[model samples]
Target: MHLPPKQGAAFDPLSEAFARDPYPAYAALRATAQPVYYAPFDIWLLSRYADVQAAALNPLSLRSLDHLMSADEMAEERRAQNWHDMPFHARFVQFSMLNADGEVHQRLRKLVFREFTPGQIERLKTGVATYVGGLFDRLGGPFDFIEDLAAHVPGLAIGRFLGVPDEDCPQLRGWSDDIVQYFDIDRTDARKALAERTTKTFYDYLTDLSKHRRRHPKDDLISRLIARWDTGELSEDEYISTCMLILMAGHGSTIDALGNGLTALLRFPDQRLMLSADRTLMPTAIQEMFRYDAPLPFFHRYASEDMEINGWELPKSTKIGLLYGSANRDPEAFADADTFDITRTPNRHLAFAAGPHFCLGNHLARLNMEAVFSQLLDRYPRIEPVTEPVFKPGLSLRGPKSLPIAVR
Candidate 1:
């Protein structure tokens, strides 16, 4: 019996050093290859902007919705861990768009698109502004912006969009936190237990909400999804899956962007001040922040067929990890890439991804960030970081877990 060679120092993608600051390691990794580099953990890392972008768009090369994890693997690693039970896993398996492909992905996306259109998102701006204003008005002295501010807004806004009750906002936030924690490799049994409990509770609540929407449809996204289900355009499983995806993805990514974007600004004060002084810079600044400190750093894909990319041969069924975070910082793509410049021109970042699966909530995420930052600067111009921003323990979603700041 032979074991895989002990993970090499030259390629530990999940190393503590790399996690703390992955830019330097990514740069080193990118220097070695164009499309593929054999990294520790038996992972194939895609780092260059062109390669990452290409891989994301090329569905024939990289399929997003394959069974990346085996049944035995899920049972032993995920289930035996006693984190969550069969029903919880079943719900996620049935409905998550991340696990769907081809016709299913397209149909589900179309249904979701009808509900989350630009007009609906535009109407959400005032509500988001009002929510941010109220939250910021209550803040004084020092606070953890991630906890006190960034995390709350998206969950609240998403709740409103989905017609989730006001009292359930905190519960939804708690569940979202737990679901995210399940993705953390370093997560403890306790965290898993908590997440499992939250998963059951959340699903029960959503089930009840689904029932309610069935009886009394309203002008909410949930109602629209229910309408589709009634017309036989969407299956019951699809409805459940789409709703869960919208609730979790819609809120989680935006929360990360808000927290991560603010942390980036704090790390570079000059850039922060530039945006603070000139309100007009908010839009470009938001794009730069996304490019500079992407919340969802990497996306996973399975190679659908044997292919050659950038001169390297890849076998079919290879698990490819597209390093969007690294690509955004690639010097070959962006001049002076490592520097956090709010004024970066022609910033074609793959933060929201690209191609057929480009994030449907891109506009909403941008709008929410712009609204929050613009309101924060307008009311309290003296916002500054008071402590180091603590990042979450997962490479998948990169953002601060807590950001302490002083705001006048």
Candidate 2:
């Protein structure tokens, strides 16, 4: 199986123009290439909404952990960068949910699902509301919402929920930022050093916390994982990996969602007013935000076997990239795809992904957004954009690094 021959030049996913704004390029690809497009990036891309959704749902054809670097390559990269051989980072390939498949994925997911249940998130709503209220009350004049409000709210909530000390929240935030910065396409030595240091610091802290939890069990998720570790249900390394995954995914994605959501709302005043007037629209608005500007633009998967998709033959062991941001805006699936309409019905966006690898923290993220926006609208009835939103430069996660806003 092969894609239909292109009438024109094949789409290049790595071009500077496409990197800057991929929607138009995706549109062109969808028009010219089949649903699956073989691009110059050594990967096939699923551009259409249907194709992307199907790929996400089909685990046999698509596997996340398979796309990551091999153990040898990962080790070589670490040594090349002069980074420490920490157990945490060393086993990152084996320890992360993104690197797991089949039964292994199911088991790790079950542990996380038990901890981050709907009830647990519902119980967290009040805390989120309180934190948002306090942050809103303290803000004066113009401030970067991403840094000042959006970023801190989720970090604080995650820290409190994880039973991490309040003092450690700031450090965790720094580590998250460093990790993100390290993933920047144009990384520098200084940035790499900072990321390594931050990662090591976090590993040290979590390692100690794991020991403490073993001695003094608590009701938190970390303690639960530690309990499983003791019973041989979960390995020691797995426990630490789970904690890191929660901390990073819990805060990192929410931070991006809030910042991006707020920017979208401010950019579209009519939508904002519509949502503010009727709070019922908040949920839909959050969904639209995820669709409009997904926290993660794309996620990687690898083809485990030779597969034919939309007339294209995907060879076994081939890496495939799904562009969620592009797929969300596919004109075939979304009416007026470019516009920001909060009350969009049947908004089945792939922002949280699909199938087994679906985000376990989706509920928490939505709850956080709803709580933050509820308090934000009530407290600052006259909130307005103070500065142009600045998007963080990364092909993976799409979010504003800085979003300045003023509340009167």
Candidate 3:
């Protein structure tokens, strides 16, 4: 049965209401019999867990259309999507491993695979804890959790992993934010120019740092990657872009996860109290938080050939939007899905996504959450929100923009 995809007439992802709470709209999307065709992005949205996981695991579904589209076609498409005219972003941000598929993605991923494994990420635990403890010590009374605490943690943790100087992490966070904001729905000229300019500035900084690492090789990711470049394993562009991706991938997302996780705890006091009473639940609580509100929610996939998803036919080159956030909340996929429960077992959420393109820095992201929340629980016996947190408006990211809290 070749049924037509449902029209997503009521799905307005850019609306302020969606920004405040998208789960209701997501629920509507999931209730449809077939995938919904959202004309705004010309992409079919898959909200169900089964449909999304199947598409992600399917070899025909790709992150990039370059394999199926001609150069001219790609150029035109880029312009159509407002992704053209940015040189540095095109070179690095646009062409990075996140957008690559097949062997290229595998090769790029392989280069850094060992560095991000659970064991490798475990080594970073001490550094993350020490830094987080210092931040907690500096806090007094009511403070903006996102700005004062959450924002500062990821940059230092990921910066240390990539061998970035502690002083430079803050600037790198700003650069990452500007570059990533353009990836969302708003592609205004100002945002494009800002993304481009920031990329160039970021590129130059990495280039200089790479040079220094080459001369005085240290025991860090950059120094190690430098050896690979010297051995002709990585091109200059590849080397620089790889470093940029590592930093950008983990920076804001981790920060957002922290903020979202804290908000979840504050909202569900019982769950918070459960985890607080039983510290063993911290790890599970962290996982529940990511499942509850995935930071990087919306990602797209392109079908390289005709495919039938749950009996609905999708033609080649059809853009399929994977709503990971929605999938995480689907009632069919999770019992009591909407309820925030720290003790939920057998949780198989798609927060880090799945299949080949699963987030490489997932372990590190989880570790940061555990460290911060564990330290927070230990430090503050009582924590309350001073003001209600407002989520950033966009379909691409999810998190409280600023969360004011009082700790005693």
The candidate scoring highest on lDDT is 3
Candidate 2 clashes between residue pairs 3 or more apart in a chain or in different chains:
none
**C-alpha lDDT score of every prediction, in listed order:** 0.75, 0.75, 0.89
The residue pairs in collision within model 1 are 11-40, 95-241
Off by over 4 Å in 3: 1-9
Q: Estimate, for each residue in 264-286, the C-alpha lDDT of model 3 and write its tens digit.
A: 99999888888889999987898
**lDDT tens per residue, model 2, 1-408:** 664443343664445565445678767766754666665544567878887877777665556433446978756755654443544454542257766788777888887787678888787788778878888888888888888888787787888778786777877777777665554334567766666667677888988877776788877777777777879988866777777777877677788899889978888999988888999898899999999988887776777777665556776776678888888989999999989999899998889988778888888889889988888888777878877776666567677778888887
Better of 1 and 2 by TM-score: 1
- A best-first ranking of the candidates according to their TM-score comes to 3, 1, 2
Task: lDDT for model 2, please.
Answer: 0.75
Error of 2 at 141 (Å): 1.3
Candidate 1, 1-408: lDDT as tens digits? 111233355755456666577788778768862437655544577889888887788766545423445666656644544534546645663247765778878877877775567888888889888888998888878988888888888877788888887678766777777676665445577776666676677777888998987898878888887888889998777776676777787677788898878878878889888998888888889999899988888877767776655555666766677889999998889998988888888899999888877888887888789888998878777777887776665567777778888887
Per-candidate TM-scores read 0.89, 0.89, 0.98
Clash count in backbone of candidate 3: 0
TM-score of 3: 0.98
Worst 10 contiguous positions by lDDT, candidate 2: 85-94
TM-score of candidate 1 relative to the true fold: 0.89
